[model samples]
Target: MSRYTRYGGGDPLAPPVDLAEALDAIGQEVMAGYSPERAMQEFLRRGGRDQAGLDDLARRVAEKRRELLARNNLDGTLQEVRELLDTAVLEERKQLARDVTMDDGDRAFREMQLEGLPPSTAAAVSELASYDWTSQEARAAYEQIKDLLGREVLDQRFAGMKQALENATDEDRAAVNEMLRDLNELLEKHRLGDDTEQEFRDFMDKHGDFFPEDPQTIEELMDALAARSAAAQRMMNSMSAEQRAELMQLSQQAFGSPELMQQLSRMDDNLRALRPGEDWSGSEEFGGDEGLGLGDGTGALQDLADLDALAEQLSQSYGGARMDDVDLDRLARQLGDDAAVDARTLAELERALRESGYLKRGSDGELRLSPRAMRELGKALLRDVATRLTSRQGQRDVRQSGAAGERSGATRQWAFGDTEPWDVPRTIGNAVRRTAGEGGVSGRVRIHVDDIEVQETEARTQAAVALLVDTSFSMAMDGRWVPMKRTALALHSLIRSRFRGDDLQLISFGRAARTMEIEELTALDARWDKGTNLHHALLLANRHFRKHPNAQPVLLVVTDGEPTSHLEPHGEVYFEYPPHPLTIAYAVRELDNAGRLGAQVTFFRLGEDPGLARFVDSMAKRVDGRVVAPELDDLGAAVVGSYLGSRAPSGQADYRDWFGGRGFWAG
Candidate 1:
């Protein structure tokens, strides 16, 4: 057996929305100092590789509105009536000319009646309603004018009535009048809050054939009626004063009865009372040669209203805006299903990002990136670094799996340059066995170099690492701010994930220096103060090193300028331009202190200023460290490789050798 269900209606073959792409883009912006909320909104506004964004949808809607207004005018009904009246008069004159049997006085009277008609089409139509025509074709044509006017007036409020009621009989007209009476009564009851669902259902059952929209409830019915009525009113307002006056007079003669107009007036009043929020007062100006009948003109106004609504929803600029506020059904009706699909995808992406725990509010109630988000962003940055390294190193494998200094449960024969602890029990056992196998066992078994054994250890070293980044305004002005953040995040990810035993500290120095977490550092915006305080940064790094006394100290400094600020003994910051002698002395003294702490330091210079380079080289020489001036794009790889090289044992291959000498200073 098989089962079936109604189709939900979209392209079944379209690819699912790519949330990863959105998340990555949002993460990048967040790292560049955008709040999590703003970053996600920016992503939605820009959309993904294959999806249309909000801005694109808004532009298309505006174009459609402009086209509608420019291509139509409101004179179709009046023009049609005038043509019919001219044909009737021409046929009557021809009949009078051929009728020799008629009396001369009667022919003259008929000619005079045709010649003395009013200038306005509606007035002429009303005056001719009582005239006795001599020609059969003339009488039929004159009658059709009233019929056409009635259908057009009805079509304005009830769409499709002009086509549906063409050449309708008196019974058809009576049924329509009865339907209008019942509809007005229902709306009046609804407005006074005295209507019930059963009454509405009964009303629909009586006249349901007239409403093809198949509204299921009273409110839906009211909404549809009210919207059509409002569009009709706006269409009338868009017409010139002369057109408006003519149409108003012609409407009173609809179906050759004044009763129809009175019922329609009552319906309009009830709808306005019930649905006051509709755009009843709105109007537009149309300047074109193509004339639209009352029905078509109302439809154009409705389209314009829909486009305006879509533009507002797509803007998402109002207070407390959300993607869910967009009306997908309305958008599809106006701009097709593909545009609706694009907007739906964007809304889903936004909802997923907000609910995925990737963003959280800090204590201050401002949105911030969560730790999980930081890890994700860090992983992406690390992958980019790996790709850069692979390309620059000619496809060499530069993957490091574990930390150093953890002991494995195995023993190996000692070799030159081995720093592992000696396996004393294994060495003694090997000596005893060797002596027993060679000859009789001596009272004192001698241990020989061949019998020496050392404990084999896994690479699980515990090291204290300090990554200091320059955060001066110059960094942002020179396009180095984002790269600096990326480099720090890459190294931070590497240590936290691959080398769990390593301790990492991120410190930023501008007018001063302070320690921060990875998320904090990534979200830190550049300050505009004018100082590069390497002295303050070194003080913080030395403190971190002292805290992790037993771990190997590794310091990586990234800067583009010489020292311009120092801390005084009284705990105040002293800043000066062009490197004050006292500031340089203070910075150099801190470097010497870091050297005494046994830190293997590396200076990753950012720019090509000769004076700054010379000063950094001198500082590196004092600490027996290395200085690498890599390209901005390669900064992450250089810092990460230097860190790995610092952790390598005395005789093992390091990241520098693995990277194939890609501008790393091998000290």
Candidate 2:
């Protein structure tokens, strides 16, 4: 082994900042690797370009590939080679049977019709039929697909199976649905997704064919994705729990002290003492039981974008039911007069919940916020911010030097904090290496204008926006909880990472209102005891902005419930479902205050409410705000749009995000 410099891996020795860059520089290396995420992350963690940095990496890779090819006299470039590899020519040859006649020998055969084989299988068979098994193409073309597709799909009923899985015949969908329902019901009863092997076998015996027989865990999902589109799958499976948690915990440990740990310990005790599965914890009233079984209570909304996914994950826990709640309390539930969750798993869940800060007390006697939870929220926001700022969509480059246009007049002589943009490449090289080996830049090294490019800065005013989410029970009426939570997570990510300067605050209202960190938003969907507290939400937002008056203030309200809770003069909380005068009055007052304070209020209503609309219409007249009736998927874009007004020019606002990279997410 000569001194080898390995490059390009999904879990690259050093991951690139951007996926594209990773593909370009170490893509070949990535193809050979087992852990793409690990390789890519590693590549990036080593001073690699983030997603935005990919373009630069791409250019560099192109240059490097060209240089290497010129030195080696290789044809085309590395990418072309990879594309050829993807063709599966060799594997295709092996599956096809060779014919001695000219039709199959000298002449290139047309597409193979494995009358019943899958398209992929048919293609594989065609190759084998086109040449002798001894041919290089046949030898190189591995038997991978056939092993995956199996004889039924390949040798016998390939076409039918493809059509069945593809056309999604009723039987196919039914199978999947039944499996999901079984999982969902189990979750409704238990909190886990697995159980004894025999029980698993029975469930699988019923729905095993719905999914692939092999690779049940999330790991399989990654493999399936990679097999389809190596690049996209690479995107889908960006980080692992181990990596994310590692980074998350490291960051948490750095931020968390003994006080924080104690604060974290209190959440479970409060939850357990409140009676099992009851509204005693005040979570249900707060939209806690939204999509996921946590019910969207103390957890945030961004976590569960898929109720189906949540159900599946929790089905293991759902294997049995707890008798502590009202439903099972009567019979003491069969199975020895108690079907309660086993102490081992219950304690495990409790520990996880507490350590995660969903349940925490710390020095506070009541269930407030946990430091660990707060840290996660902060990290969530940070990750969200990183993604938004690095998003490759709107913005083109990450060259930040404040000024963008001609560098003739605007850029002055080198001044403190003024970046060298004229010769950007050099500027970055210098700046990045400045704090390297020897200490600092030597003034003796004269700088020239060529070494200066006024790093183009997109001029846009920053805004402070607060996303006020409704914690009303109505929003959770149809199990719309998953989408809502995912929306929050995506939005926070869009705002913080993309528009770092823009101030983003999250507030939820049910009985009372509270400002939550980004991490808190993910777990908020489980809050179930819901009644709209629009007034308090607005009031809370108004108060939140008062602390940051200088920033452009805007309120983005996401609600599916009408005003039902509002603060009263008597210091008592009031609740009314259909349009309460006091609630409406309080909501309007808060809006009026926002208008006076020059804040734009935008509402994305999930459900229809005449009173809420009338109130919004009433408030719109006084203040600059917009209302949009939105579905869950549209939340991320809508909030991002509000942040970047419709009339705003090319660079009015920009959100750049680079996701699932390593070290950034590593412990």
Candidate 3:
């Protein structure tokens, strides 16, 4: 309820502050191909809906379109059609026109000058003719047409179309020639097939500059629009992927390159500014600039959260509870069919994933994790957990013990051959006692090495942890996995960013137990119910920790299932639910090894009265570990405490995690 995408007043044509712009900024930046919805969200977060210039442009375009709709047989705004035609022309031609043209209308209408007519007159004709239908001479001949039109009106009329068309396509450029033919056909009929004066006027206003008055046909109008988009498409196809990406990057930074990206960027605002569903009435300069080479249309998923708006509304019913009931399918369903994604959106997401390192395609054409993406997911969790704990506490990396380098302190009586800070009183007393006693120092009162034992700092014990999460359907079955996943990400982020010195491994177990690279976390769509192999997960985790003895080894297992799978040496898996004895035994094999390695096994169960309690309790005693009950939002917090130690509630000896890890999730 806090967020609504307003139809805000804005400069529809200003250079977009979009994902490309975000990526160019310093620090962690949004990558290219970010979800359009996310892109807009981030843009708004940084302050969008603020450009008056674009708003003015949109209004003007819309107004011009309205005017055209009132008079011409055209289909779109002046700027829209001009922009479309401009797309048909070479970039070199656009530059030439911009160089010569001054006014926005002139620059936009310059495409009409393709006929080689004077740019000024051609632009004017394109603008006026786009909305009305009448021969230059015939219309003028109607003096009462003059009386009907008014002196100011006649003056506004464009110069002549033939004057430009004769030379514009004299060379018969295949594309331009085809366009000319279509225009000629549309003009030959009634007001471009517009039966009503209003429709005719709209058509004229939208395409008067380009379409001939002689041919009035609806097919022609459609053809013209298609040709323009086609031309743009062709232009894109002509370039290599690298070239296109490079050009896109450069164009997005239109302040510098201004031609390609800047022009494309303006298209959206320009189109919006026009007559909307009507014809081209806006001035020529309006839509053609594009500002940046990126296209308009806001992409299908421009505001993805919008697709989830209904779900968000439904979620509000949860008030302070039922948060765990949130469903991704419901979120997806929130979108109406028209706004749903297609091939284009998928390609965009894939590109973004590749750029973000979330999806990598290997030689075998399979999805794999890139190192950077993997690191990012882990880093995300690490940061989340660290922040959660540190707000109320201090950095808890680790503390060294007195085992390494013991410090020296003197005992009472000084003995010979000992290094110590001599205690005068104790030495004197010892001498006096010797004079008066049976058991005392004889001649020289000196401290001996045996009596003066130096205290050494205990080597700070390091903990090597392997986090095993159940990826089986059952975990998500209880609708707890996302929080679990987030918990994992938060924990990973915390360790990497805050506890830079800790050793951590991330592993998820389902039918198979294997270590996952960090990049795979976000894109993971685990098969929820394939099988929950708690035994295999633990075994793999234990094997990983066995290599590191210097560290206090531990297994942080996040699951909501009992043992279900174990492997025979031959590589086949044996899976049985309801606590199969073989699976239980296999789990014990690893739990027992963990106990022998002196590593504790901390169990994290996320269900009410979990059936696996007895099995867990037994394992806990075997390794002297503990289990935590996770509240929905407390998953990350609980997991964090496993590595970071916590103090007792009682005002007694403060038990720290030893290493400076925030026991954020300390249970």
RMSD of each: 9.2, 28.6, 22.0
Model 3 deviation from native, Cα RMSD in Å? 22.0
List, residue by residue over 28-84, the lDDT tens digit for candidate 1.
897677777788888888877877788888889998888888888999889988999
For model 2, the superposed segments whose C-alpha errors exceed 4 Å read 1-458, 608-612, 646-667
Please give the TM-score that candidate 3 achieves against the real structure. Answer: 0.42
Considering lDDT, which of the candidate structures 2 and 3 is the better prediction for this target?
3
Per-residue lDDT of 363 in model 3: 70
Candidate 2, residues 489-604, lDDT tens digits: the string is 65665455435666778888877788887544543435567577778788888887898878778788887766778888776788876667778788888888888888877878
Candidate 3 per-residue lDDT, tens place, 134-246, comes to 22332232222112112111111212321343322324223333433333333444333435445545656655655543335454544433333333333334344553443
Q: For model 1, state the Cα shift of residue 372 in Å.
A: 3.8
TM-score-superior candidate, 1 or 3: 1
Ranking by TM-score: 1, 3, 2
- Tell me the TM-score of model 2: 0.37
TM accuracy, model 1 = 0.83
**Every model's TM-score:** 0.83, 0.37, 0.42
For model 2, give the 10-residue run with minimal summed lDDT: 293-302
- Write down the lDDT that model 1 would get: 0.85
